[model samples]
Target: MSTSGKKATATALAQKYAPQIANKTVLITGVSPKSLGATFVTAIAVSSPALLILAGRNAAKVEETTKAIRAAAPHVPVRFLNLDLADRESVRKAAETVLSWEDVPSIDVLVNNACIIGSEYKLIDGCEAHFVVNYLHPFLFTNLLLPKVLAVKGRVVNVASDCHRWHHIRFSDLNFDVSVSWKISQKSAAHLHPKQNGKIYNMWQAYGQSKTANMLFSLALARRLGGRGIVTNSVHPGIIQTNAASHLDPAEIPRLIEQVELQCGLANQEITSYKTVDEGTATHVYAAFEPGLKDHNGAYLLDSHVADPLEDPVAAWGTSEADAEKLWRLSEKLLGENFEW
Candidate 1:
């Protein structure tokens, strides 16, 4: 599809599925005003949820988002919870705070929307920065809050990316310590170099793997919790220009975009194929509340509907039951605790 066509489709989906959360309590992570998470809070608040909890590493940014939501929907209840996804301790503390809310008996919707991309390589909990922050943190946080979600038959919406189609998880060297590199060849397939001299880490590859993990997590969670009435799904929120890309070098962004487009079979060399923040949040909102999705748990949503994982090899890996189970076990090992579902 052309860039303009994609944008139109995104806008239409946002308008068609603007369901309100009503009396449900919703918790969303990554609410910096500059990102799509803030727009998500605004959308949920306008729907008049019972309570809206905004979480982010930056207390000030979370406060900013909360204030705006309150100002717009004064009748809707709003709260801010400080959360740093880079630190497992912070994730646990944040979960504890949510679990301690005496008045809010259940959480009806949990949006794991926070993520980082194209940042300098770092480690958290002895894992790659992107892997920990984008995948492990959410994995732990969601498991910690799973009981509350199950109590309400809640929906878990993970904001994954279509870029996940470009790469699969590197289980052997997830930390990039072996100097591996992934390049999208002209054939639109990812090729890996096990030993690339002077290239310690590839941020784009790490981002893709992290997003693939998000989809796998959703699939695994859905399978584990399906009978319990909780729903989990991952969504490609239509690439949008947001602060999530702030850490990326400006010139590199276009190059990465071009690569993704090629992988997705798009001819657009220009990286302008993106949705507005409002449009980008639509798929997750749809996944969070659309009753039609009740039976579609573990689905990867694109353009506001279930997308076929067979469309890409990396996507297939993400939706693989075996891979999901493997990732779940690895996550438990890394977190040093078994997640009892």
Candidate 2:
């Protein structure tokens, strides 16, 4: 509600916090060419961070992001680590690699930005693909690297989304059967094609649940690290046309929006608008380096400011303390590790 007229642009914030970002070691996951993660890397590269580590599954794509940063900011140091979010061993290996770097002992900023948005039903290590790649693995990777973050009393930014308001954590069935029919209004069902009418594997809704988990995870970590001086926050980077949405057919976008509106009980209101990649990266950059946010741990950011639930229409379920604690326990149980902060 304190937000004035327009959101602060990434360019302005980068310049304002150049001193804070300079010489700070930053690590970001899910970096790839033309993606939101890559755009975020580019935005911060201009500030000349001491180190920038890009983590992702595709080595070549991650390299592309690195090359672009090199071209623009030749003096900025950049590194890449092979990371497969769906694989527990790969996530652990990536963390170990960062820990072993004698030259770079601590990570000043860690951005868990990698995610998959898909409608297909697939399992990775006996867990649903979206939940594993988007939520569980990030949870595991962050916990593994907590020591590095603690070394400098750094910041952790989880790139969540406003779409999280669409669904709550399906605690009872985190791996719900996507093939089953999802009950909804007849009007909302009318928007889907005949074949997709009763299907519950709606890509956006599934993605929403994972993003909600991201917010909850940030809340839980912030609570545990309350006075340790390590700031943790979730961000809703503006909507953008990136590779993350490649699974969705372009032609179906309008109908999909209609489905979302109908399901959320918002009949005719405009729900979203597209953003340029740079525009989309503003909030992520804001959450990562903005000195003003040092005292606002566990905050959810939108448009480069702490989001107010009253003004933003963010669902209470996404920020529920009870749900955050429950998800934290579930994450430790599923990973078979105690991540005591």
Candidate 3:
């Protein structure tokens, strides 16, 4: 839980439960085109599973990603499904597809790796972008697919991040109507460049919010699912610059100072702490198919190993009956009662 900007300095990861992935079914959650999602999907495909599901919202993208997976493991069983975690109907349909698998093949591994970075305070079916993309989507997808995953007593890997430390859930205003961002004001004062303008405003704040939500969601999931023989843990996939950064509208435009004060923005650095797609998927790949610590069910990992907090145990969240109840109710509100759990 060390939130320092530094990537995990330690190299050792916990593997007390290693060797549990022999001939197990693993699902990479975000196998979209041109993404670390594809990288993870390809890596796992090479492992040769009984069944591989390359899923995403884009049909062509899924086809391309699955094609890459197929090229890597020509003989491995693979299927591509267009899955939109942000949409309830799409999620439900995906569950049906997953449940209809032949022989009801157990899902041994699941990576909740889908994410989006939006700063416009947009809403997806009334849910905020950060909360919806980072937590609720994965939460609903996991809950709906539990039956398919539980049979194998699978491991659920959540791709969280240390940037989470930048902020916490403003429970009151999860939406940005009144939320804070570094783009316009710093401690109530304007940023260094008041006259400057950018298409994506407060990109870091939006990202930090989403990242924090991911950790909390992971923590809660780990606690709730750990006792059921399903291993759940979160990992801060080292800053492997994914398309997530491009999610924001990045166009630096000049604007009046007074006008900028109302809606100022940011100009993110072109080069971030990016890693190769393979390197980016290292943490997830280890969590998915690697054999070593298969029994360490409810723990956090960094640098592909168990990352016990160097000092204080960070507060991600706990998935108690009460918390689960709250999360579900809130999700329902976000999606409306018309949506199924």
State each candidate's clash count: 0, 0, 11
lDDT of 3 by residue, 47-77 (tens): 4567776667778767887788779778777
Best by lDDT: 2
Q: After superposition, how far is residue 39 of candidate 2 from its true place, in Å?
A: 1.0
Candidate 2 lDDT over residue span 38-89, tens digit each: 9878877898899999999899999889899999899998998999998999
| Global fold similarity of model 1 (TM-score) | 0.86
TM-scores of the candidates in the order shown: 0.86, 0.89, 0.73
- The models' CA-based lDDT, in order, is 0.78, 0.82, 0.59
lDDT of 1 by residue, 1-341 (tens): 11122343323443444454678888998889857888877766766678988888888888888888888689988888889999889999999998998997899999999999877778776788989989999999999998889888889998899778656777766776564335433122213444332155767778888999999999899899988998889988876778888766665667777776576455644556557777777776778877878789888887666786455323577788898998999899888899777
lDDT at 10 for candidate 3?
15
Per-residue error (Å), model 3, residue 120: 2.6
Q: Which ten residues in a row have the lowest lDDT in candidate 2?
A: 189-198
Angstrom error at residue 259, model 3? 21
Angstrom error of the Cα, residue 194, model 1: value is 12
Q: What lDDT score goes with residue 224 in model 1?
A: 94
Candidate rank order under lDDT: 2, 1, 3
